[model samples]
Target: MHLPSRPRVATRPVQLAPRPPQLVGRDETVAELRERLLGSDVRPAVVAVHGLGGVGKTSLTLEYAYRLQQEYDLVWQLPAAEPAVLSAAFARLAALMGLRELGADAADPVDQVHAALAARTDPWLLIFDNVPEAEALLPFLPPVGPGHVLVTSRSGRWPRDQGLELPVLDLVSAARLLLSSSGQDDEVAAADVVSELGALPLALEQAAAYMSETGLALSEYLDLLHHQRAELLAQGQAWGYRERVASTWQFAFERLARTSPQAIALLRLLSCYAHEAIPSHLLLSPLERWAPRELFRADVQRRRAYGRIPGPPARLLRDVHPSVLVMMRALPRDTLRINAALTALRRHSLIGPPVDGAVTVHRLVQAVTLDQLSRRVQRRWREVAAVLVEAVLPDDPGQKARWPRYARLLPHIRTVLGPTSPGMDKTARYLGASGDYRTARSLFQEIAAALAAALGPEEGATLTARHELALWTGEAGDPTAARDQYVALLPVYERVLGPRHPHTLTTRHNLAQWTGRAGDPVAARDQYAALIPIRRWVSGPEHPDTLTTQANLAQWTGQAGDAAAARDQYATLLPVRERVLGAGHPATVTTREQLAHWTARARP
Candidate 1:
């Protein structure tokens, strides 16, 4: 089709769909997005507004384009679902720039568009609406220059830093959308509607349209939504919006079912989970168990069929079914089939964009899908989810390295393990490691009682848990309580394990360490001096426990204002530490740093 041309190199105003006149509750987001568009930072040339379907990724951007039309010299909007659509839009823009003659002679219109884009010096804006994949648009995108490109997509497949997940509105904003749409100030009904719809934009819009069209009150809308969610979602509105929230995803799920039943199957299992950041690993990959590898591997074949597709012991499985486990496995090579399934789901907006190293499925999407599945199936999937979580939780949550792992799994842990679970102590240890000492102390206190009941007052686990509680109580800030706990515990350890047993000495060491930390360096130095002989006698002079005591004595000697002695002690300890634990080891390095610190202090 030949096109009439305008003046050469002339610019056009921003083009986009008509935004809602009252875009309530997205002011902060719009401001942040605008800054991203205009800010001089290392962000990508193309910024993708991404999230679950109906989360307002497009609406938010469209509203920005409408409000800030005068800021740009040239603007263009395209339905960028297919590369062909982008090419066509480019041709139209080329025609607008009076390059019709050049475009006619050009073998590739896309190339012509790129040439035009390169020559342009004007501040322009390009909005690629409904981009299925950000990667596909790279070829045709204007080379990083005088223009900004905005993309709206359901996929989080774009670069993480370049994508913004436009969230649903807060209560005030959602209520405003509802009240304004219905043309009323019924604040109470608006609150009910927002609560019922879970602050989802599409659901709120549809519900408001229904209320306005049928002359229903907010209470009526809420009741109708509860009684007939599908009915409400299926109803069409006369406004610009054409699809209901449930209907949009219903079609998406139907489409996902066609090519990747695995995607739909995962959604069904995800619906049984807590929803939103429900550990992609829990659904996509298997964990390497430390303690119960055999128990974890008992149903390995069943796991492959349902949870993870298994490989040999040393091999890593990329994709796991939600019924087996769920967590994202960021394997560049694993994307062939399992990633294809995720891409298919992303195309439908069945899941939210991935964020903070995890992918989130919308809570509403999960709730709706669960409603579709049979109760029996839901029960079984729920059990699988619980089992997967329990199996994946680390053996030792007290370790600092395990904190991130613990945080990632805590929500799922809550689902599977309760206060009485044997694993509760592990959870408490994690809480302590995360710096929530009070909660950890309380948990330890509860578990200590439980342990006392289940396995005698002086049993190993019970005594250990009580000992940990004392340390954490000190950390939580009552040294007196910690002192009393150690004072009480020392007698038990001394009587039960003997005074020179490793555990009894450890209790004494802690009591003395607290004495130094609580402002009596002299007493602590004396305590350490006394404890050192016993530690050496009980556990030979070169034993790690004896070395630890010697190291503490040096630190306490310095705290008692004897820097020369401390430096000499650390200089001696450095050699033994290097021999025992390589020079590059963290503890060895720490001893070196301490020696340097004391050396500096001792010097004039």
Candidate 2:
């Protein structure tokens, strides 16, 4: 099709979609896009707005183009899903620039458009919408021009610092969209709908459009959504969109299923996790106990071959289907398989790329993915997820070194295991370590009550849960309550577990510590004095708990008005702490500092 020629290049030529009248939640993004594509200098600026499908990348780009089109002499929007269609689009631009005669004789019409746009002194903007790949568009970009090129793609293959990834709308913006699009004003119901829909723009728009069309109240829509989520997601008419939310994602899911079943499996497992950051490192840690030894060695060799350091161990395939185990074994290495799976999922926008070493799957994505699975398959994946999380949790939640690991997996643990599971004991400890003492107290209280009811009050787990509850009472600034609880529980521990048992000793230590913290340092010092010899004899002087008791004894002794005795005790304790815990360890450092303080007080 031949095109009619327009005036020469100085004349303004624009081919753009109409401006989006109300682009909620993207003002900042649009401003940043304008700044990135500003034609301030002679250098050509290319920025890629990358996001998952139906995230409104096209709407954002069109908004930027239409809002700022008047500042440029030329503006064009090119459809870039195919390289051939892109060339034809550029040829049309060439004809619009009055270069039809030149393009007819030229070997490549795309080159003619690029040269004309490149040579122009006036500013121009070219938007390459829905680019499938960065490399495919490289040849079509005008070299060293005053124009800005904006490309939008679902794939995040752009150079670092040149890509802007758009996430879903925030809660407020989503509510605004729901209400304004549907012409409804029920803020409460709007919040519920947006939460259910995961703040996804396309889903929100579809839901609002459905309500507007059907004369349904927001409350009715929400209730209907709960009962018929998949149907509602699929039923919306295309309100300026060719595909509804479900079909848009279904296409990606279908494509992913055909190309990367490993990614499909990974996504399914992720669906069973809470819709929060899933710690990628924990799942892929190289030190994972259940990783096949041969695969680990092969992965190490592979890393050496690539001149890269081996990373953490990948997750185990425990209690999973036999087919999954076979699939895992067929791969070269676990890490390689996982990385490939992540890449595939990212390419299709089915999962967000890793951020802060964690990946987040949208809640709606989780809902839809789980909804599509057979009940048996969903049950199996949920079981596999629980095993994966439990296997990665460190044995000691008290170790500060493992706090980040716990933090990353805590959400998933709470999701898969529920609040009262024995697994939550570690979560309660983690909460205490993180200074959330009150929350730890409440959690332990519930856990202790539940365990006592289920397993009998004298069961070991119930006693431990009660013990944690009392400990956090002191930590939460109620040392009197802590002291009283420990006072009541110590005899029970001694009678039930025997006096020399570690649990009884631990209870004794806490009782003494809280006695001092509750303002009776003399009594606390006496209690510690009585317990230290037994602790040393039973658990050894250098056991961490024993050292902890000794340290507390010195603190209480000083507080009980015996600075000289405290000085001598800390001096004696310092060397043991240094030798056993290391000189730079925080506990040893505290001992040294304490010895200096008490020595000064005693001398004066």
lDDT of each: 0.71, 0.79
* Over 4 Å off, model 2: 1-14, 40-44, 72-74, 83-124, 139-146, 188-196, 214-231, 286-289, 292-337, 351-356, 418-423, 449-457, 477-604
Count of clashes in candidate 2: 6
* Model 2 steric clash pairs: 284-313, 285-312, 285-313, 286-312, 286-313, 287-313
Give the CA lDDT, 0 to 100, for residue 462 in model 2.
Answer: 78
TM-score of each model, in listed order: 0.55, 0.71
Model 2, position 109, has a per-residue lDDT of: 80
Candidate 1's residue-wise lDDT over 261-337, tens digit each? 76776666556665547666443444333322332444354334322222553343222244333222221113355
* TM-score quality measure for candidate 1: 0.55
Backbone collisions counted per model: 14, 6
Please estimate how well model 2 matches the true structure, expressed as its whole-model Cα lDDT: 0.79
